[model samples]
Target chain A: MTSPIAGGVDCDLHPAVPHLTSLLPYMNDYWRDQVTTRGMTDLISQSYPVNSPISSRPDWRPVKGKPGSDIADLQRQALDRFGTAYGICNPLYGVQMVFSEDMANAFCRALNDWLAKEWLDKDERLRGSIVIPVQSIEKAVAEIERCAADKRFVQVLMLVMGDMPLGKRHYWPIYAAAERFGLPIGIHAGSAYHNPPTSVGWGSYHIEDYVAQAQAFQTQLTSLIVEGVFARHPNLKMVMLESGFTWLPPFLWRLHKFWRGVRMETPWVDRAPLEIVRSNIRFSLQPVDAPPESDTLNRLFDHMQSDELILFSTDYPHWQFDGDEVLPKGLSPDLVRKIMIDNPHATYPRLTVKEMTP
Target chain B: MNVQLRERPQAASSTGIKSAIADCDIHPARATKDELHPYLAKRWHGHIETFGVHAYQGMMEGPPYPKAQPNASRRDAYPPEGGPQGSSLSFMQKQHLDPNNVALGVLNPLNTGQGIRNQDLAAAICAAINDWQIEKWTSKDARLKGSVVVANEDGVSAAAEIRKRAGDKNFVQVLLLSRNVEPLGQRRYWPIYEAAQEAGLPIGVHAFGFGGNPITASGWPSYYIEEMVGHSQCQQTALASLVLEGVFERFPKLKMVMVEAGFGWAPSLAWRLDKVFSKLHGEVPHLKRKPSEYIRDHIWWTTQPMEDPESRDHLFQVIEWIGWDKLLFATDYPHWDYDEPSRVLPAGVSDANRQAFYLDNAKQLYGIS
Candidate 1:
């Protein structure tokens, strides 16, 4: 009977919107009428199919309603159970999938409001991520501008696999806005399904889509670095949530190798990709993909070179681990403190500011 | 330009490989653009002259992500006799094969018509390239073996070509690009796998192809580095598709070797698949075994641009998870990201593992012995 670690900051907690209709009170009157008149039901992203074991831990799951819908459950299971000092709410509603730009923006606004009022307001330990409708760059920036003033919003949220790679110049405005407010852009796994989940084409099994998330994260990481996103936004930090980090060492080796060989094409990339990653990129700690043995996990950590890269997270109700074994076995007590507290504080400046405020 | 593989120490040391060595990936290029023209029919000659192959990438003449260096080859690799890297057989032997003591080298020729949109043209070009590999490579050197390049999009035709080359010593395996119009596991590609199984040849899915899809799950990336890194991701999707589509169950005898793309992700990829499989096995009732079991049995990977982690043993851990025998040594010779024989396998590898990784595995997989 081991004790759970206390005072850790949980970086990724998915607070599910109970149903599409629940956002009605938060939505503008015009959009509320539009949603009801259109007869919209659930907009759950297939990425997290309800009832999939990975969608929610069997033990934490409720008898009814959505897996991550209840604030009380999140507070007890995710916050108190793990002794988390703060838990960031990254609502995984299918607002990113809405085809209509107008619909996506409206829903994104409503989702942000719902997150603040229902979840953040309920728990002082909870923080919010601004879920931007990324279909239109201008609107995405506008949403960021609207949400940035709310000090409770700690990060800007986007899906890992969107219609375009996240690094395109068009999307820089949103990054710029987020940067202005010291908000790190958190890229979570799952796609818009605007394209096939896999690079080649769609796969038959749900597991195939799940496996492809790591690959999608790698592509976006490459996109972010090689497309000069890191170079352009020198101080901006990008957090990859639910993105596995075991593949990082080799990925950096391969990317750094090519960047050296072909520096002429993208001359703006003045420093090594690995250096850039160490500086600007932060990865969530969950879904440890290395073999379960702590020795194997530690060896991968050795490969990671920097201990500061990983921040702790339960990936709440996501069934990434069995019980309270959210932190993999191998980490040292010092590393545990950094992963759970220091790293998350460093990556998310708002957490530090809020902690300092009171 | 500053590659040290060309100048890496050649002396056989205590740690050096003592037995036979096999390089599973050696990309042989064309000296000239019309090198395979003579192998093609006169009908294709005019089509080639006028209607060029339609590719999925935006650019018709060059790759979507422009390669960092010309031909994406090592600076030292271009033959003094004046042709592209790997274009001259003698240069390969002098620079890589003989020096590295490669006893068996498999030729994987790229920039072929195998992936083009026109099925007829792709078929003709594939056959021509197949014939050309025999005349220009295998016939000239017994150390090398050829891969039967096929029009992978046209499954029936790809199978026919495999059957045509079946049991032929000139070719040791069938070659399919990682990226295709549809995931290779689709019924569209089963014919090729079936024929390869019948032929007793492993199908090598080297990482490069375009099926009109973006190089990434998102869309076209900005740099060649992304494409290079994207190779492993593309192969991951390929393996996932093949596993979940029950390609292994349908033709259990068909073996696959993922070439060029690093194999570090295999164990984790399989682990995730198996983890999910335990819950969602009902979705794929056709599968008799777990996804890892299928992967462990049927899939093999070649080492090139090998994972150079901070701790060398970290790679060994992945190799341990992905069984030692499943890895075949590859140099990806003449390419800029070539993995030299001595340099790739980090220190502390046991003799038995090294023997299997460098020689025994490829020999058994390709039946070279």
Candidate 2:
């Protein structure tokens, strides 16, 4: 399928960078240890095994070689397939491994440096998220500070699952730094070692397991709100990545109900939970289609209270979802343009506004 | 006005009904220690050890069974303030009645311990819950009604309680949650159904999790969504048990409502059951009607956390599969992931179906008049 650029911006395209291995040496030791311990070190190595594809699924496999494992190959595929002028590359190294605070910081710094050297420095269209090990507040903050001056670093990427409640005041230092640097906090779902909220023994099958992932995202989001993180860090912007938007409407209403009654516990929150979410929270809709007849996308738009809150994401190379036409088929052209291009541009203006035609 | 009248066919059908809406699932506050201690026969006090609370807090907390993510930030943990005062009673009045949006709310027991173990306590607790609901909720708030929750573990005691509470004007149904009991068609539970049918009250089968049961494929889920989504599966299991066991046929008037379970999965199950039964009629000759027909005639469902986006088309598909009247709208208020009435139904749903899903169907099922 030919990838069509919506409103001149192909929001789903991702650029890849080579030379990530060279920068890996500069990564924090804690992250290196995490990659080894979390089994991600093995998984990453296996992805590029000589004979086979990185991901076993045929749909996710690259045309000839493993495109996902090599940053340069990934960029070539993006330009060739989608005619993408620029792309936001969420690196595999930052997300696939679980790192301690120190290691997470080092890994993030190394990845950011590599991104700057290999993609951001060379390509006008390339933008990046500073990957940080969220476990250590100090390291996460330092990494954010290190990347703050870079024009291509659009946001700070943090994996959502961890041992402590995300809204806990201990993480305030990172939020303070992100806020200071004017960088949005991008939280992606999925972690190698951390037990997500849905780790509860809930279902017997694959559908049940996938549903559990959505639930974990909801729980984490609620923790961020009820724990007063949004209220305390009013300027902090958060993007809930990977989780679909179908569940947000009901969750928002319930959160508001709890917030009204539980105000005594978290007095710092001046407004209802829904209001806080609307003000600070953003969600990326990837793997977007679900039973097309359900009109899920439209309802999600309504439930989110604003179309602007949802940004388009393709989760490229993942199987189970449409390759390029991730958005619902029947939506009016206007709605498609908003979701595929305008909304993301509005949220991450810096990346969206960069020179693309050249 | 003519255009509005044309839009609501279901509401149009309810011109003579007493109320516009009736909620099928409402849980009443449990007895305070003071009210419950005396009702406890000496042997049951030992059972209280299983649940740490001394009768009163047990009632306030609802079930003693812990959810997958008990500490996860949940929206349902706090109830709206300034609406009602008593722990259980206040929620009904404050959340359901005061809003005037709900005309009649059916009440269930908060504590399921009586149903799980110690039949005597279960019977006593259910009885106490019904009477307390009547005294505090139904009597003062005309919108409140009651369900007779019997101890599923002991059918005899459960039947007796059903027989006792079925005749009360305020008690309109029987409450049997999805998680606690054996399949509804099991011979052990027939007595309770018989009693409920004789009393003219439908059975309310709500969803819960693997409290003591090791039935879940893999233990329990660690997250609340997993627990909540699993309710649909439990509902399917219970629904199948009841249908295949001929609970609907044995007690023809014994209607049941599957609460807090998603409705999208219902039609597929009905089709699957109907298709399987057609080929295997010899296996279960007791069924007088097709499985799908039985569900349309006897089963009803409540929608909370109503799977929006899907709710629009899915509700229509379910209504087409069963009939237009099988669904009832609920808020599942004071719990996390509560559905807001205004926001729940999608924009494109016709007004007639919307009214049916939102209110009228529940009234018709409960015989609100």
Candidate 3:
């Protein structure tokens, strides 16, 4: 187990689209005309600003185009480079930014279709997540049902910060639908900006905004656990993609401590908060925010205890790590194998190939 | 300006939990608004009686979370004399100060007038709360000390209030809430810091205030647990704003004490802050030092709702990163989650760390003897 797993499953890889026009061919005539007439050039990216240093690694950024625009480039960099056997492509094209429920629904449909046609259809190793317009639960559930037919669409994608807490009852339908289809609910790190990233009003810098995303992840975790999202949808898999994993240990410790003190208020949360998290929630391991020291990473892991909670991810095109050192400094060989291979297989029920009947 | 060193707690008897020490964060609320009438001006008596106080929360009268007992306090803390919990000094002495052997208990009066909408009324109430602390609690007991409560929104008046109490040895710090109209680092609240620095008082930012925003960034949390855990997030944001916005660089002498906001996240937050600051250094050129350096130098943290990691080693690791010297002992007296000094830490912690944590550091910070 000391050797790195070559055919590791990459749970999160972004397939970038340069502009809204790229999806126009996939959209119906009514929505296409509406978008073009409105001069909606490109949907504003809520998470990654185009020119921000965090958007894409310098070497990975295209010499003359979008970072992940080319299928050949993604294959070369993410799959071939990392020896990834199966890579789940998550296209963050700002389709979820559309305000109107109808427009948002149309964009989500177009994005899913575009992903199926362009990336998933082109590569056998590539899997995709259905980007849903989380603004309207009805439309979000409808899109989930529509995409459930495609086995390649293995997960439901939504932003971490949105119109409301994902755990709220209004959004539980999305979770229920995903559970029915065996699609893991993948919450990406981004915000709708309906509110400030911090509890205080808007921050002054991008650094503040970027650092505050960790807190958003923490809040949403509590929301999901306390709101009984896990209890109702027992089999649901909630994957927080591009959300750093190091913060989870301390966050869970504090959550579980408080739960012990105030469990009566949330009777549905019968188990300890940490237990609920280990059993239901999984976090992507890229953008590891732990200190570079091996000891610190080991200490964090000791607190976490469970091997299945972290899923391997390259977070392709994003500049989280400098080189091939996507894994933190000091994870044990067995834990690495679990994170890179077995964990992702367990998290995404559709990722594994079934044995042929003799 | 001679600094006085308090007598060391008769050398850690057995478990190394000091019996006699300064309790940095002890909330002493008024039993009723009528108790504060003597401290308030005649002009605002009618205003208080008529309009009452309006806090920047979802509800008009109570806090957002109803699970917190009526006063948002411990039921056991309610005085036998029929007043609210923590309102009676005699009961506090018997229940907390006497049994706990608190040498100096700092009064952090909340819910009196800290988050009110009316600036004049808010300032008046804050002043009255401070006076009420001295009259009913601190002045009566020689071991009790008051924290000058200020209406943070009105910096001018808040500063004036600080100046008035500057010479009083009984008041050791200026009390402000983490949830304020703006981040404490912003210029809008600088006057309070300036006065605090001038008065040689540290600013103790306690959890729970009405900063005109929900406890969470998205909205109000559904349960008491979310609200409780969210306290650290608010404190993190405040501390980040204070350090990154160059508040510490401007007022070099100003010290901050993060009360009831656990320190487990401090080391992690500092690491993240330094990581972000190195890249965005130009945005805040005035910050002469690293974010962690300012935090280590200017800020002190109180251990009340102390973080409980799965292994005792994890707790020690957090303490190591935060530096034992930076910690000040506190028991959010009368609060349901109050940490007893003897039992707070895991068994393996050394006597030296325990002594510094419980007594020495806080005594030095407050110049208490």
Candidate 4:
């Protein structure tokens, strides 16, 4: 199949790099001390080890007649398979690096720089999320300020599970920085280090725990909206990343219900939760393998107040995802265009379509 | 009261008596730690201590777990605190069990001694929790039914407890939290099942983080958020274990209800299990029925954190996969994510399906009529 370079932008992609070894120095001293004391040095180890088949080290050559493991090769595969024009590359470290505040910040800075130099520098179509050390607000804001000047940095990436609630006032600084930079903040599910607060206690394993991350994102998003973060920082755009979109409709309804009764508690929240979401929130619809029916998606759109809220994401390399071809089959062409292209263009305007023929 | 009885007869004559639904997964407010402590075993003092006020923190570490910013170790890790007190339960009752809302609520003990591996201590703990629940919740509310936890590690003891509690009008089911039990069909657990079957109490299998089961997720998530998401897989595994082991065949009258496990994945899991059974039929010929059929005949499910907007459609899809009668509505109260019964049902659900899911199905399952 020929790759179609439609002007559409794929909002979720990952540019793989040797895990966060490069950014170790920029972390806060306190976080560095914590990691050293806790003996959690190996936290950043990728699921694939150095000798593993998926590892894409520079020195490793593909066996004769075998496929290579380079970032460019993966990008080529995505381009060939998805007809992707430009993609907002969500790096792996940002999701996985959560041990000490220092380690997280350093890793994010390193990953952002590597992303900028390797992928963004090489192609105008390759935009990136600035991975901020969310544990360290000062470093996170500093990184956002430093990277926002780069046109390719379109969003600040955060993992949904963390030490503080996303709506907590401590996170205001990061939101303010994103607003200042005109960058949307992307919150993805599944981090190796922290578990999201579930209604139930943490389950025994990864699959069960990871599944809660999406719910946590919903809760966090609700926290952010209901706590008046969105109202306080009106310009900040938030994207729920990697989590599936089906559960959102009920969540919005529940939020509105709470808003009605508890408006007194959060009087600063100028509008209903759904309205805030409609105006500011964008969700990336990835792994659409379990995408709700068109009718369900349509109802959700109605409830949330806009179709522009759902953006397209591939969650590349994740198993059990709906490939690009399968994504557009269930939706009308216009909705498909909005999910796969226009919504992302509207959210991240700096992501320009590049002409690439394959 | 006489007028109401006369009115009931007249109402019944007019509407043809709709059966009352029994919610098998209701939770009443737990007794205060001070009230409950006197009844519990001394060793179990630590369990409540670590868990705090809720007794069962569900999957959450009650207190003294590493906080984001730690100052000092908490007083006791055994019973964590700062959870649902009396006020929280009052809020839950107001929201979930208002007469204008859901008419009935079944109270499940938060911390049951049955899941602990120590048989003697487990039994003592179970008894204390049941007593505390009865005194604090069931005694005050007729809308509530009780689920008694028995010592599962010792089936004889567990069965004895079930038998003893079976005759109690307030007790409706035997509550077993998911942990490292042998498959439900195994000979070891059969005594408890038999007692429950004889008593006409359905088995309630709720998920927990510790004991009985190994954590299957790849890594430990640092926060509670990761743990909650990972619950569905555990639910699936538990149900699959019970089904594949022929638990349904061994106890035809026994009903099993999965709680807090969302139904979104049920349709797919049931379909996949049936297909697998078709391919591996030779492996276990003792199971004559399809897995989905067993589920439909014997299994029930409660909806909470009811994935809204699509709540109706999601329930419909599962009903389409299993049968409509197998679905039940529940509000896992006192927990932070408790679904408000009044608002849980989306505006889109058809009346017929709503009646089945919200009322009729549970009525039949719990023999409310």
Candidate 5:
């Protein structure tokens, strides 16, 4: 059933990178010259090919450029349409795609700046995700430090699929920065393409690649849990953007089951996997990946054991749900409130900016 | 038989429902140490001593994340005779097979060299494992049946092994690990599927096989829990590869029983595959039917590492979506996360569904009279 109410917070809305030229203004002199000299084209991701149905809803697509590129369209279709009190702009630009560490850092800086200038700065209601070069922890931490000053930048963003599992100690510096800055780590669906999209091998179709993304998130989530990411950085929250929520309950159950038998390996995991997930993980509600029956979806909610786990999202311009029915059918009124507003506020403490006295 | 069926023996099941049932996923280690070495040619032994088994990873000790328990087996399962937990027949019967009333138990022998990169060595070890299964365990135990363990990466050798074991009453299916060199559906692995179909034996892809790559697509995880949960994730990829790449269409009669991987993910994975296939059917035009249809027509799943969702009904919903007949009951005996058949299924299951889940499905799938 569609939510009868408004005033929700859309946690995951993509503001597309129009083309390489748009990022030039944000890039430094050396990178700008390199881009012009190399004559690079747009860096749209393969996971969300521009023409694919999954990339953007039919009406939400911008006629001139990429979907979510035009701020006016996103405002009309997403914010105003849903009466979103606050919306987080998770830029799905290819900032983490470059092989060179310096190039990745440059692109990430440009992406964050572009999100701030083009999206966040334009709308008081919209917030930005700080895209970081995940390959280099030093650069990633530096980027987090640079962007945390904006307060408008609420979360540090990285791809679900990257060079290694996000839980490894190598990536802990980024998480440490996020925890220190009171910014959650927003892990969005998409990959750095360093490895095959799947553990077995590369699949033939885009659908295979897209569907396989959930598996990537599962692996990464497990890595985070087993690797003691949460145990070490206890205060941090990791938001799964566009990585569906319905799968979380079972995924946690599986981990909890195995963790019992293998608890000795990671002694830092002092609590149950379920408890850790409750304490740290939050999923943005979109692409529900659920059966249509309200009762069935409701049963899944029951299995999840908490209403506060999901923050609301239209996954705007991503063709997740048509029209406004961004909220799935089964949520009760109280549950909707938790998902739409309370959950987001609780997950991203930085969502509410305080006034400076100076 | 009817009177005995009506009786409720406490030891027969952890829950109340008690009757002799078929267990689809029992792992039986060798009866004695070095039992398989006799089956292997002497030259391989010298090669093994000189170079050792080249594991997929750098470590020779085994998985990077060690199990909480020794060999990831039940502490009580170790035999008094000083072998591994599953390495003794009488001990297994005493602990699990007899007490649980496991009428017909299928043996899944893991930790073979099927996952090694050296194809010739993998094939030799696989052949030795096949011989060891018969001469050691299945030959002595009438209730036990063997799986034709194959070098999953070397399809040609695997198929040849399957053909060699064709119509052997002791052997019921061919075994492959969920994690392989590539998705099992690729043409490289088609030969094994074809041979299994020709032999009229189901191919059982059990979770936790020979590990080749970092179990996760991105890389190795921090803990063994990631590897454990990764079993289902890898199987999803295997099922998708099999359906999308026309494994089912090409080998129409081939039957696949996904053992040890939890069954909860089947409905959702198939649904996701169907949704994507509808939009991107052109990419895989070779598919003769929807991915879900192929899944319904071909695949069978075993219930091990049974999902304990917050609500029992969620598992019921998954089963209802997958179908009543599609699930084969398994007790991952001697393993750390073993599911007791009596206690695993949620309470209030109908007798007919229980019959299908515990006994009828596996009996029919394996062609057991």
Candidate 6:
């Protein structure tokens, strides 16, 4: 496999929060007191099973701490090894799992502050996604507004499977806020477990759980398009993080075919679903979930006419791919460059500004 | 098998006459619930009038996401004679079978009550549907064939139903729903498979059933669009369950056909299953082969709402991954998105592959001569 060129932007890198106590310092006095008094330090890991082979790459795991907790280790393994000039840190924690809107908001605030201070502040190459409390739209929008002030926070992170379909009007404020600040909404592959991952119910093993992520992404994409999220917020960008890309071409095809037949129902969706997906939705590269054969990837790329849809993501500490195999083998050099750097720059307005600056 | 079946494609292509097509998924619904009343037992006829259907799903009218049209079908598909879409054999012949040059059309009548909770009721309704198809459709048109509908929830009865229709040439395959009480591979459903294999019939699994579970893992999807696209996901789970649980290993001769659920995901699903099964083979010790091997050897996919990739070449690649011989043509007749046989395949397909996809594949699988 060919190594990615230097100066590429890593769109998805998980910054681990070791323990609940770690974020306690970042919380406000009232929230800090509430945590101490309530003894609410045991935050559950939302999607990641700590010991899964996929949660941490064998090489990236630290000798002492949780795999992604150490900043120096991440820099050495992800940034230095892949030659990623800019890496976006998406902190996945159990903040979205909290039921109370107030508590969820408090945890989200602490999570963002901790991310900004521990990861983004320590490394110039590091950028972050503002972790928001998606349980309540008002608080999510407020959180987005609060974090948008810092250009280092390039995107807003929402779990792919949430309480309601992400396209409903209740969630429009969050999309509107992200669009206003020119920030893309990053829907990462994690679930709140509000419902079973499959419509039939939960699967028996992790493989079923892991495989179901692609299906979840499909549901969200269709929901967003049909609910008129794109038509309403024309300038918004939806980046599907760690969601496999190969399944998309077929899903879009099915979507478009049905759209042609049922366009009368969703009248606002004027164009074909494929056209809308190309213009609005984007997918991350790693966990390619495709046949390793070069011809398969080539045909997939051919199906995905636009090269800009895929942004380079190592998904650091996540064992999606092995060694320098971050970029799938068959891509041409031009396509590689576009995925690693050009696509990220185009997707995130903040990244463009960073590149232009001295 | 008929020698003319292979030559028919070439002859039809060369002549102005439409090419011979074998539609593996043509839905034929009842004009009214009362139509099945004659075939149903006296008890069921009274039950239908009173309580109505008590399916596994929350609502009996249909899926939560109301179809684009009244039966979730194309508006124009409603017959000129004024019955619900797909209810009239004469209308189907004029609009779909005859116009499309469908040499053999396999009827998958879903309204036969597969999802109903009461096994006896579901079985009774399934039997009535079979008798109804013979009287209304297969008997009326020599070109039309039927799928033996069964209450998959109760395998004993389902096997019996399969056996009852096995000798009849009009019934080609045993039809089951994608959504069921349990994953199809489990021992509960094995009897149905045994009956099918013994009878030398392929099991045709059409999408849409009330499996006593939400349409999605995340709960009922809010929109019709999400529910529609989800048809393939259900099939993916079923195929994985069938392979991993060793259904193919136990019943080697059993042929399975996935109809209506698009074929695009088959390649990815097989790859994912094989990739995981390689490392986790211990979980399913009964399997002797890779998941893809069983899928390739046993399972056949029908192409309707056939994947239309942005690049036509991409769809060709998908077709290649899913071998031409394993693919059977289906139009999902009278549904909102029926693919016209002539227009479905893109330019890159070779004449031989095209002939096999439209006719020969289904003929060999169903033993149609």
Give the per-residue lDDT digits (tens) of candidate 6, residues A108-153.
9999989988888899999989989988889999999988888888
Per-residue lDDT of B266-314 in model 4, one digit per residue for the tens?
6545544564455345555668898778877887888765644424554
Which residue pairs in model 6 clash with each other?
A: A198-B217, A199-B216, A199-B217
**Model 6: residue A287 alpha-carbon error in angstroms:** 1.5
lDDT of 6 at B29: 86
- Candidate 6 yields a Cα-based lDDT of 0.83
Query: What DockQ does each listed candidate score?
Result: 0.61, 0.02, 0.56, 0.06, 0.59, 0.42
- Score candidate 2 by lDDT: 0.58
Best by DockQ: 1
- Minimum summed lDDT over a 10-residue window in model 3 chain A is located at A349-358
Error of 5 at B330 (Å): 1.9
Model 3: per-residue lDDT, tens digit, B206-321?
98888787666666667778888888888888888888788898899999999998888887788777866765676678888989999999989998888888788888887888
Interface RMSD score of each model: 1.6, 10.3, 1.6, 9.2, 1.7, 2.1
Answer with 4 or 5, whichever has the higher TM-score: 5
- B284-367 per-residue lDDT for model 1 (tens digits): 888999898999999999988787655676777778888998999998988887886877787798889889999999999888
Cα lDDT for residue A140, model 3? Answer: 90
User: Which order, best to worst by DockQ?
Assistant: 1, 5, 3, 6, 4, 2
Per-residue lDDT of candidate 2, residues B1-369 (tens digit) = 011233322222223432355555554443345455554566556656555433311333543334332322133333455221234555545444555357777765545444344455657666666666667668887777777666776778888888777667887778877765344566877888888888888888777632343223223333233344445555665676678778788888888888876665565456445544543455577888988788878888787656443244544543555565777877665454556555666667777877787678877777776
Stretches of candidate 1 off by over 4 Å are A1-3, A352-358, B2-20, B80-82
| CAPRI category for model 5 | medium
Put down candidate 5 lDDT per residue, B125-233, tens digits, no spaces.
9889888888878888888999998878778888899999998999999998888777777888989998999999999998876445667778767666777788889
> Please, what is the whole-model Cα lDDT of each candidate in the order they appear?
0.86, 0.58, 0.82, 0.61, 0.83, 0.83
lDDT tens digits, residue span A1-358, model 4: 1122366577777555543333444445765565467664343333323333222322223343122225666566565466677778887653345566765666666677777777777766678888888777898899899888776788888877666567778889999988876788898765544432333233332233333454556556666775678778887889988666655654554455445534655578898777788788888876332324565444434544567888876555443232344363346667777777778878875565232211
Write down the TM-score of every candidate. 0.94, 0.61, 0.94, 0.66, 0.93, 0.90
Question: What docking tier does model 3 reach?
Answer: medium
